[model samples]
Each structure stands twice: as C-alpha cells, then as structure tokens.
Target: MTAQAVIQVFILVLILAGGILAVWLRDLLAAVIALAGASLLVSLEFYILQAPDVAIAEAGIGAALTTAIYVIALRRTRRKEKE
Candidate 1:
C-alpha cells in the first residue's frame, strides 16, 4: 500500500476510536481527552485538505477551548459529587 493510504487509514482509525471512546467511556475526563485527540486529527485533516483557516479554528476552538470547558465542568461537578 502507498504511504498516503497508510496515513489515511491511521487517521481514520484514530477518528473512529476517539468517537467510540467519547461515547462509551464512563469517565467524563477521559471522554474529553479522547475528543480533543479527535479534534486534533480533524484539524490535521483540514490542513491536508488545504483549509488553513478551518484547521486553525478547529485546533483552537475544538481542541483547546472545548477541552478546557469540559475539564472545568467535570471538575466542578466532581467536587459537588464529593460534597
């Protein structure tokens, strides 16, 4: 197989695994981490598709902001659960 095909398969696996983990994982934090990985992979795919603006937005908003928000929310709720 060609290198490009191999890379494509790898990316596809990452994306699918991330999706599955995000859905099936019981821990909120782990789901967020998996989703962040998916976001980064999507951003890379966008870059490969020659959409720099979309890639940047996905990296910043999808990977960074979403992850930060989810983590913070999880911490907050977990603290409440402990109380």
Candidate 2:
C-alpha cells in the first residue's frame, strides 16, 4: 500500500484505541480526555483526506469545544464513576 494510506490506517487505529480507552476508563475526566484525543485524531485524518474545512470544524467543535463543555460539566459534578 501507499505511504499515505498506511498513515491513514495508523491514524484510524489510534482513533479506535482512544475510543476504546475512553469507554474502558472508569474515571470520567480520563474518559473525556481520551474522547478529545480521538476527536483530534479524527480531525487529523480529515485533513489528510483533503478536507481542511471539515478538519478544522472537527478540531474546534469535537476536540476543543466539546471537551471544554465536558470538562466544565465534569467539574460541576464528580470525576469518578459511582458504584
């Protein structure tokens, strides 16, 4: 395969790993961080795919804005899952 395709596949693997980590973590803040990381990776993937506008939007909204909102909400609440 091409180098670009290989990079895309690597990014996809990282994105999936981040998603899995986010879901597997018991701490809410950690989960949010993982989600943001996944979002950033997705934005990078979009950029590599030749969609700069969409990449910017994803980075801004998905990685930054949403993460900020989640952090604010997490701050207002608790950081760990209650059992």
- RMSD (Å) per prediction: 3.2, 0.7
Q: Lowest-scoring 10 consecutive residues by lDDT in candidate 1? A: 74-83
- TM-score of candidate 2 on Cα atoms, chains taken together: 0.96
What lDDT score is found at residue 70 in candidate 2? 98
- Which candidate's lDDT is highest? 2
TM-score of each: 0.85, 0.96
| lDDT of the structure predicted as candidate 2 | 0.97
> On residues 1-82, what C-alpha lDDT tens digit does candidate 1 reach at each position?
9887788788889999999988878777888899999999999888877899999999999999999998888876862222
Per-residue error for 19 in candidate 2, Å, reads: 0.5
At residue 28, candidate 1 shows an lDDT of 72
lDDT score of residue 57 within candidate 2:
98
Which candidate number maximizes TM-score? 2
lDDT of each: 0.87, 0.97
